[model samples]
Target: MDYRLEQDLLGDKNIEVSSYSGINTARALENFDLGGKTVNLHLIKEIALIKKAAAMTNKKLKFLQEDKADAIIKASEEVIDGKFDNEFKVSAFQGGAGTSTNMNVNEVIANRAIELLGGAKGEYDLVHPLNHVNMSQSTNDVYPSALRIAAIRLIRKLSTSLSSLQEALQIKENDFADIIKLGRTQLMDALPMTAGQGFGAYAKAIERDRWRIYKVEERLRQINLGGTAIGTGLNATNRYVFMMTDIIQDLTGLGIARSDYPMDITQNCDIFVETSGLLKSCSVNLLKISNDLRLLNSGPRGGFGEIILPKMQAGSTIMPGKVNPVIPEMVAQVSLRVISNDTAITMASSMGQLELNAFVPLIAECLLESLELLDRSVVLFKEKCIDDLLMDKDRCLENLENSLVSATALVPYIGYDKASLVSKKALSSGKTIREILLEEQILPIETIDKILSPNELIRTHISGK
Candidate 1:
C-alpha cells in the first residue's frame, strides 16, 4: 500500500488495467469503490437518446464498425434486458462533468465488446477505449445525452405509478357513490356529499398530473449530442452527428432529435429545470391527496367518522388494538422529501453560471431520487390506501341526516330567513330538521321528500344545478 510504489506500479501509467479488469464487471465494480450506487440500467432510456443522437450524424467512428457496433448494440440490448444493472457505479455526484460516468460506460462497453470479439484481457490494442469505444464523441455530449435518457426513464416509471393511483381512485368513486356524508369546508361541516365524489376528485387531479409529466417527457427527447464541447460541433463531423442519431434511433426505438440550437444546449439546462418543475407540481398534487386521505381516515371512533381505511398495522405500541392510517401518513412524509428534493433541483439549475451547468451532477441526483421515492409512494397508496377503502354507509347517512346542510335546500321553499331560524333552532334543541319541519307543519311530508332526499341533494351537490 506504499503510495509511491503503488503509483509507480498502477497509477499514472493508467497501467493497463486488464481489458478484463474493466471487463471483469466484478473487478471494476470492486476496485472503483463506487459505493452501492450504479448507473441504473433503467437509465437506458437516456442511453438510448445518446445513441440516437450519435447515429443521426453518420460519424463513421470505431464504435460504429459493423462488429463493434454490433457488440455495443448487443451490450445495449443487455442493458434493456437489465443485464448490466449494478455496473453503473458512476456516482451522480462525480466530478469532471460526468466524465467519470462517460468513461465508466466507455470502458465497460469496450471490454465487453472485446470479450465478445474473442479477445483476451488488456486487449485495448485490439479495441481501445478512446480510440474505438468512444470514437466521434466527447464526454460533454454523451454525458448529457445519457442524463436525459436516465431522466426520461425515471419519469416514465413515475407516470405509470401515478396512473395506477388514478385508476384506484376512479374505482373508489363508483364504490362509494351512494354513501352520503357531511362535507366540510375549512375543516368544518358545511354540506352533504357522497364519499364517491371526494375520491373522484382525487382521481381527476392525478389524471391531470399524468398529462403534465407527458409534456416533460416530450422536452427530454430533445438532446444535444452532436454539439460536442460547448455546442460548436468541434472535433466532430456533420455526418457523424446525423448518422449517430439514426443508429441510436434503430437501437433504442426512442424518437430522439438533435438540438436545433447546439450552442444553447451547452449554455443552458432549462429542460432539466422545466421537467423537474413539472415533477414538483405533481408532488404538490400528491401532497394534497395524501392530506385529504389522512383526514378522511383520521378516526375509526373519535375523529371525522366518515370513512374507514384498511388498517395495515398497530397504530402504537402502548395503545392496544389501535389501527392507524399509516399508509396515507407515509405518503405525506414522502411528499415532504420530494418537495425538499425539488428545492435542490431548483438551486442546482440556477447555479449554472456559464456555458456548462456544473451543477448537473447534483440536478440528476435529486431528480432521480425524487422519482424513485415518488414511485414507491404511489404504489403504496394504490395498494394500501385506495384499493381497500370502505365507506361507513350507515354512519355517512346518520351524519348527513343530522347536519344543518339540509337547510340549504329549504331556502327555495321556506325562504332563507325561515330556513335560518329553523336551522338555529334545530342546532340548539338537538332535534333533527325533519322533526322540526314536521312540528312546524309549514310543509307536508311529500314536499319534504321531493325537496331534500339524500339522493336528490347529492345530485345537486355534484352538479351545482
Candidate 2:
C-alpha cells in the first residue's frame, strides 16, 4: 500500500504523489490521502457528545459494542481532559472534506485507547477507525459540528474579555465624574460636558454590544450535527439529531440545540455571517472609543490639550522629550484588523453557492482569528489605555473657559444675537467669554456666572456627575 499515491473522492486528480520520509512526508501523505484528519479535535468533541447522547437514548450502533465503546469513550475522555492535544496536530485546512483530520483523530484515539487497554499502537484491527470508533458518523456532520462548538467556546471566552473591558470603563466614568470639559462637534467646541459623560456613553455602547453578542450566541446553539453529508442522513439513525444536541448541551454545559430545519442548517452558512456581523458591530464600538481616546489625548502643548494620556514610551530617540499614545494606537490597529477580518468572513459566508457551504474552513479561520485578536485587544485597551488615563483638570477647565461655546448657554439670558455678539468679541480679543460678557456689560455678572460657569453649564443639558 503506497500511501503517497492515494487519491481523494473529490477533485484534485492532478495531484502528484510525494514519496518522502519523516514527519514532512507524513504531512504530505496526509494531504494526499482522503482529506481531513482521522480525528479532528472538534470531531472528537462531537463524537463524545454523540456517544453521550446515544447512551442516554439506548440507541445501539452495530459497530459500537460494550468493550470497544467503553475504550473509545475513555479515549474521548482523555481528549476532553486535554491529554491528546499534541497528537491531533493536522491543520484544519486539509484536503478530502476533512477526512484526514477525522481519520487523524480517530487513529490517535484508537492508539491511545489501545495503550489504555494494554495493547500495541496501530491496533485498529481491534478498535477500527471507520468500523467502531466512527460508527454512525461522517466528516460532514462531525466537521461542522466541531467547528460550531469550537466557535461557541471561543466566543464565550471573548465575551468575558468584553465584559471585563466594559466594567473598567464604568469605573473610569465614576473616577472622572467631576472633570468638566468642552464637548466637540465636528472637532469644534460645541458645549460643556463632564468627562464622565463621555466615558459613560462609551460604557453604554459596549454594554449594548455585549447584549448583541448574547443574542448571536443563541444563533450558534442551533447546530446541524445529524444532517450527515448534505442533510441526507445516509448513515445515521433518525434518533441521532436531537439526542446529539442534548449530549452536546450536557458536555459543554451550554444551551446548544438542534435546528428544526436540518437541511437548512446543514446547507446554510448564514448563521456564521450573522454572528460575524454582530462581532464587527462590537468592534466598531471599540474603534469609536479608541478613536475618541486618541483624539482626546492628541496633544498636551499645541493641539486641543484638553486631556493627557498615560505616556507609554519616548516617542523618538532623536527627540529629547516626546511621548506617544502607543497603547491606544495599538488598539486602533487591532480594531481595524478585526473590522477587516469581519469583511473577509462576510465574503466567505456570501460565497457559499451550493447545497453545502465549502467556504466554512475559511469562515472558521477568520472568525477564530478575529475573536482572539479582539479578546487580547480589549484587555490591552482597558489596562494600558483607558485604566491608566489621566485627566488634566486645569487644562480642561482652561480650554472650556476660553472656548466660545458658552454662547449657547446664554441664549436664555442675553438672547441669541446678543450672545453671538459676546462670542465674536471673546474670540477676536482672545479673552474669556465670561470676562467679555462682564466687561462689555452685555450681561450682568450673575447672569454670566449662571451661563458661563463650567460646572453650571455642564449640569444644564448634560447629566451631572
Candidate 3:
C-alpha cells in the first residue's frame, strides 16, 4: 500500500495515499482504540455541517479566499452527504474531551478539500485542517454544537415514532372498547373495565412521552458554536461569532440560535442531563407498557389469557406448539437499554469539570443510541405488536364474571355491605357473582341482569334505577 507522510504537532505519521483522513485522525485511531464503537455518523455529519457553515461565514466576512472556502464547502457537503463515512475512523470513546473526534473530522474534510482543489490528499499547503477547514472554531465548541444538532435531528425522529406508537394504542383502545375485563390492582382483581380503557391509559402515557420529547428538543437549539476554546470566543472574531449560528440554522433548516451565555453553554452540560432524563422518562413508560402488554397476553391457557399478542416466533426450543410475545419482549429490552444509556449520559454530564465536559463523546454515543433505539423499537412495536393485537372477548367476559371485581358495580345499587356479602358468597361457593346474585334473589332478576351486564358494568357512571 502506497502511503503519504503527514505531520501534526505530535510528529510525522504515514497516512495511506487513498485515505481522506490525515495525521491527527491516524493518531486518534492508534491512541483511542479502546472501544470498537466508532464515532456516530450523525455527529460526524453535523460536524461537517458546521465546517461548511464556518467556511461560508469566513468567505462572507472576507477572512478566507473564495477559492479555498469553496473547496472546503464542497468537501464538507460531501461529508454531510455521507460520501466519506468510512473516513471518520476514530473511536467514540476517547480522551481530549472529543478533540480527537473533532480533529478527525477536520482532517478528513481538509484532506478531501485538498483533493477537490487539484492537490494530493496530504497537501496541507493547499488546505491545512486547522488553518483552513477549522478556522474560527475550537473542538470545545464544535463538538458540543454538533452533538446538539445531531440530537435535535434524532429527537424529531423519535417524537414522530412516539406519535405513531400513541396512535396505534389509541386505535387499540377504540377497537377493544366493548371487550370487558377484570382490572387488577396489586395483582388482585379490583374492578371491571373495558380492555379499551386499559389501552387508553397506555395511549395517554405515550402521549405524554411524545409531548416531553417535543418540548425538550427546544433546549438543544441554543448552542455555543463560536465560543472557541473555553467559550470566550477567544480566537474567533465577533462578526463570525454572531453570524455562525444563523448560517448553521439556514443550512440545517433548524431553529438553532447562539447561546445567551456562551460560557454557560460551554461550562455546564445540564441541558443534556435534563434531555436524557426525558428520554429516561419515555423509556420508563415504554418499559411499563411493554410489560403490561406481556402480562395481558401472558397465556393461551395458563395466565391472564385476556388479550393475545401477535405471535412473532416460536416460544421454545424444547416445548412444542408454543408462541411468545416476542415484539413486546423486544420493546421491553430496548426500553431497558435506553434506560441504561440514560444513566451513562447522566454520569458523563455531571462529571464535567470547570471549563468543559470531557465526557461529551460518551454522552453523544449513549444519547444517540437511546434515540435511535427508541425510534426503531417504537415503530416495530406499533407495526408488529400493538396494531395486530387480538382480544378474547369471551375470555375477558369470563374473567370479569368469575371475579369479585364486578361486585363493586353492585355497590352503587345494593349498597357496600350487601355487595361485600355477595362477593364473599361467590368466593366461598366457587360460583360467579352473577350466579350467586341470581340464586340468592339479592335483587329482582331483571335488575340483577341489568347490573351484571358487561356494558352497564363498564360504564363510567354506574347508577341503580
Candidate 4:
C-alpha cells in the first residue's frame, strides 16, 4: 500500500512505490476503470522494445548521457522479456489515440530505469518518462509502429501453425488416398472422390493461407516510428529517425522500415484492415473445412457416416455411447470468433480521423486476438484432430454404393438423359447403378463392373472419359 506521488500535465497522482509505472499509468488506471479489460501485454512488450531502440539511438546520437540511456535500455529490455507484465493496467478500449497506453509504457520504463540507476522511484531528474524514455517519439508514431511489430510476430506464429496444420492434412490426404467416397454439392451426393482428395483440398487451402500470411509480414514491416506527433518527424533528429529504426530491426531481426510517409502511416490503418482481411479469409476456410469434417464425421450409425473424426471426449452423459467431433467443432467456433474480430477491426480502422486513428488500441486488440486464436486453434486442430484423422473406408465405399451419384460416372458413357433416368430408377428401386445397368444388360456385365469400379470413376472425372 506504500505509494509515491508523481506529476503529469494533469498534476500529481499517487502510484505504488514498488510498481514500475508512474502517475500517467496511475491516471490511466483511474480513467479506464469502468472497463474490465486491460491493455494487451504483447503491445506493452512491443512498446518497451521501441523505447529500448529509442534509448540506444539517443545514446549513439549523444542526445542522452550513457548512464541514463544504458539504464533505460536495460529497464526496457526487462519489460520486453516480460519482467513487469502486471504493471500495465490501461484498458485496451481507451481514449487518446493510444496515448494513455504509450505513456503507461513510458512511465513504467522511467520508474524501472530510475531504480536501475540506484535512484528513488519518483525521482524524475535521473530518468524522466517523457524527456528520457519517450524522447523523439509520439504516441501517434510509436503505437502504430509497435502494433506492426506485434502483428509481424503474431503472424509468424500463425504462419508456422498453419504450415504444421497443412502438413498434417497432407498426411491425411495421402493416408486416405485410396478410400473412395461420395462427394457432395448443396449437401447432396454429387460425385465420387477419394477421401484423400478431400483432405488434399483442405491442405491446399491452408497452404494458400500460409502464403498469404507470409506476404503480409512484408506489408506490416513498413512503419512510421520516427514520424513524431503527426508524421512530421517533429522534434526527432535525422540521425535518431534513421538509426532508431535500424536499431529496432537489429533488436528484433524483423525487416521493419521507416515509412517515407509517416503521416500516411499515422492517419491510416488500412494495412491492419488488409491484414485482418487475410486472417478472415483463413478463418472462413477453416470454418468450411471444419464444418465439412463435422459433417463427414456426423454419425457412427445414423448420419452421412462417411468418415469418423477422432473422439477426444465422450459426447453426452445420457446418449449411452456417443463420441463427438469435438476438435473440429472447437476449431469451427474459433474460426467464427476470428471472423467476427475481423469485422470489428475493419469497423475500427474505418473510424480513423484527421491525424490519427483513435481506435488503434481496439485495432491492436482485435487483430492480435484474431492472430492468437488462429495460431492456437490451428495448432490444436493439427495435434488433436488432423494428426490422428482416420477415414472410414468401408463406410465411405458403402455410402458411395448407396448414392445414385455413380449415375454421374455413367453420364459420359450413357449420355445425360439416360443417366438421369437411370439415377431416378436406381433411387426409386433402392438398387445400385451397376445392378440396374446389369439388369438392363446395358454394355454387358464385364463392362458395367469396369465402368463402376471406384478407380475408373476417379479416372473418368480426371480425364472426362
TM-score of each model, in listed order:
0.84, 0.85, 0.96, 0.96
379 Cα displacement, candidate 3 (Å): 0.7
Q: Which 10 consecutive positions of candidate 3 have the poorest summed lDDT? A: 456-465
Model 2 over residues 1-465: C-alpha lDDT tens digits? 223232234433222222111232245355656454333344446544554444333334343566666777777677666676666555655545555566666665665666677776555566666666666667666666777777777788778888888898899899999999989999888998898899999999988887787667877877777777777777777776666677678878888887777678766888788878888888888888888887877776777666678787889889878788788788778878878878887887787666676666667766777777787888888888778887888888888877888788877766888878888888899887778777878766666565566677766462111
- For candidate 2, the TM-score is 0.85
Model 2 residue-pair collision total: 24
| lDDT tens readout by residue for model 3, 1-465 | 999987766778888999988787888888887767999999999999999999999999999989899999999999999999988878999988999888888888888888888999888989988998899999999998999999999999999999999999999999988777898999899888888999899999999999999999889999998898899888898899888988998998999999978988887888888888998899899899989888988878989888888878888999998998888889889889988988898899899999988998899999988889999999999999998988998888788777888788788777999999998998999988888888888788788777777677666677344
Expressed as tens digits, the lDDT of each residue in 5-90 for candidate 1 is: 11212333233444222432333444556576654444533553354334333325543556666665455455456565555665
Q: Pick the candidate with the highest lDDT.
A: 3
lDDT of 4 by residue, 2-108 (tens): 98887767777777788877777777777788677788888889999999999999999999999999999999999988888888778888888899999888988
